[model samples]
Target: MDVQLRQLRAFVAVVDEGTFTDAAILLGVSQAAVSRSVAALETTLGTRLLDRSNQRVTLTGAGGRIVTRARRVLDEVDRLERIAQEARPELRVGYAYAALGKHTRHLMKAWAVAHPAVPLMFVQSNTPTAGLSEGIADIAVIRRTLADERFDMASVGCEARYAAVDTEHPLARRRSVRLEQLTRYTVAIDKRSGTTTPELWPATMRPQTRTVDGVDEWLTVIAGGQAIGVTAEATANQNPRPGVAYRLVTDAPRIDVRLAWWRDDPPPCLDTLLAMIRELYSAAPPGLPRQRVPMVVPPRARGRH
Candidate 1:
């Protein structure tokens, strides 16, 4: 009932070293202490573990069986400790959809060079906060503003909105389409994780909507010509489907790409990541306009309506 790790270690040490004195020296403890620890272990198990009647210390039959299992337990405990110590070094960034779009690879390469000691990992989770709320990620790249009070986020960049339509659809022939034109089709949206919502349209002009769980489903539905999808321009660049065509939504507001983390105890590299991303967006090529929105928002005012 009351077993301790030290007791197990002491028993195994005495068995391997062939004597209590040698085991005590290996453990940096007194011989009497090692003897007491082994005795306590045997008492707890209600069995005699060591045959002290012999000149050379030997194990009882029960002790031999238990020792093998005890050694395995000790080894697992050591492994767990090592994992816990190494766990904090890696940074995991979660995303619901296109993670920073075309900038993802460039940002990863830059971080590798800038912080070689700390590794970067990307996780995809189709929840609204990516994996932040689920505790699977230290930071998340989300398309919309997160209104949760527990998180702090920054607008790292913005991208033009685009409509995804079937390749054979009439609108696919046009170079771009306005928000009003999209209202004519049934729009597919991922209500849980998607940035596009019915609220984006005026009350009376709102398009009929269909719900999909993730990006792939949305693309599939759009490709089937039963619905159309409105998403960040990055989605077009990141996920190009053969049956789907992406067209610019010239009248819709640009989608904001945000980086978010828990506010109370943010990762140590948060500020560095923010700066690196800000620089990446600022250095975008001539044609792409870089819009720098102020990063911080008041805690209580954070979630999507």
Candidate 2:
């Protein structure tokens, strides 16, 4: 009944990476350490979690049933640790790629003027929840809608899509590019936190893909001229890398920016924070300049599409 967090992490990593060697590499540990941790986890749970017969590792029925619960436990532990490490009272806003794009600093200054007592801070986490679920941030700025009912969300604004290309690439010379136009090239994507996916294109027109883990890697691949990337406009504003250029994706749909927090345990000054965000968004509707954001609209009331 005694289980360690490291054991759970090792089991989860192996399940995620499909090989012990890869899991070790991810965790910055040796392969023997990963194997020992998994073994210890299985012993503690009194269940065989993995099938290691083939070149790739797979989950047993028990593992399939337990992985989700394990993830929840880890997330809760992480949240607890974050709460314990707090140095002061401040609003921690999380984002995966770009935090509010060009609106980030304006929002911070506005919050400072309104809530002078509590500082507003932005943190980056390359996860789907942008560090919200991981307990790294008090709230999250997410491009994609959260389906989890435990959290409540409101749309703050929408941003146009852009194509990231190498400076030497032909697409870099164009003012804008169409979705179909990039189909002939390989697309670099972050499946975990990135908004763009192969699903965005028609099945027949979908381009070859190279998977990257984060914004830095995505930019590197694109800068190498081996691949291109599609992302929200905020990336262009916040992450202008050398040898990489961003052009508008004229045919792509705009990405909605939303603020999400725990529904049952809303943060302090929640209403004030939400109002400030909406005010900012309304003032500038993506392409406009210095427009106030609108009133709060709940996630349930709006469809992602």
Candidate 3:
């Protein structure tokens, strides 16, 4: 008999328990079966695995080596099983840089409970809303998006855009200010996540520009009155930066939060997750514009030759 897994199990159990009878009880096998397995293993390995005399059962040098190797083999087998179990019912979800806030974290936990069967896999990407179109993700939560003929778009929520400014700013006294009123102030944004190029170049105001990796840094600058910024409402509430205040941007585009999936036949649970998400977070719809990547028409089609 070649060195086998069963033999190793029996050998380890007997060594661990210090007796064949105890090992048999632990393994739920007869004592004679346990003893036979160990003896077989010793013969196959050509090494005495244990020192046994009278009532004493101890490991030999060879036995010590086998046990060390055996434990590793068992551990690897267990790991493979766990990985296999996690691979089922998986969802590849993506979020944009700005959208990766407390809402995502909170919604993730709620989503987990709502759909215990789905294995969610999320990635933060620049193309947050286009994930479904690019075939990189099953779903995406995005802001500044619009209806896509290729997609069945509906508002999951929205985030009110806050005019971030210092406590001492001239406009800070009022509860709110129209976006156009801040034309004179510098505006920083996550330009990467924006839909337009130079993105601020298309704007009415040529405000000073500052590109940030995320919202936290923008908050700091806003608090210092160096530059004003816009943030999702959920973010503003998380930590209203010290010496800083936020208020609605009047006539400003509210960030539209949407749950977008492929217009094609989606997984059954996708529908369920969407329903639960709406039910749970239906209150306080994130205030923001619903934006989308529009399919561009060819120049040939646009000109009336």
Best by TM-score: 1
Assess every candidate by TM-score: 0.74, 0.65, 0.56
Please give the lDDT score for candidate 1.
0.87
- lDDT, residue 96, candidate 3: 62
Q: Write the per-residue lDDT of candidate 2 for residues 1-305, one digit (tens) a residue.
A: 89999999999999999999999999999999999999999999999999999999999999999899999999999999998787677889999999988888998888899889889989999998999989999999989857999899988778899898888777776777899999999999899999998988988899999999999999999989889999998898888788888888899989888889988878778889888878877887564222122334567878766
TM-score of structure candidate 3: 0.56
Residues 1-305 of candidate 1: C-alpha lDDT, one tens digit per residue = 89899999999999999999999999999999999999999999999999999767999999999999999999999999999997768899999888877778998999999999888888999998999999988999988768899998888877888888887787877778898998989999899889899999999899999999999999999989889999987787778877888888888997778888999979768889988887877787412222122334558879956
Which runs in model 3 stand beyond 4 Å of their true positions? 1-7, 12-30, 36-72, 78-141, 144-155, 192-204, 259-270, 280-282, 285-305
RMSD of 1: 12.0
The better-scoring model by TM-score among 1 and 3 is 1
Candidate 2 TM-score to native? 0.65
What residue pairs clash in candidate 1, if any at all?
146-302, 147-302, 147-303
User: Candidate 1: misplaced stretches above 4 Å?
Assistant: 1-11, 16-53, 58-80, 85-88, 285-305
lDDT, candidates in the order shown:
0.87, 0.88, 0.68
Ten residues in sequence with the least summed lDDT for candidate 1: 286-295
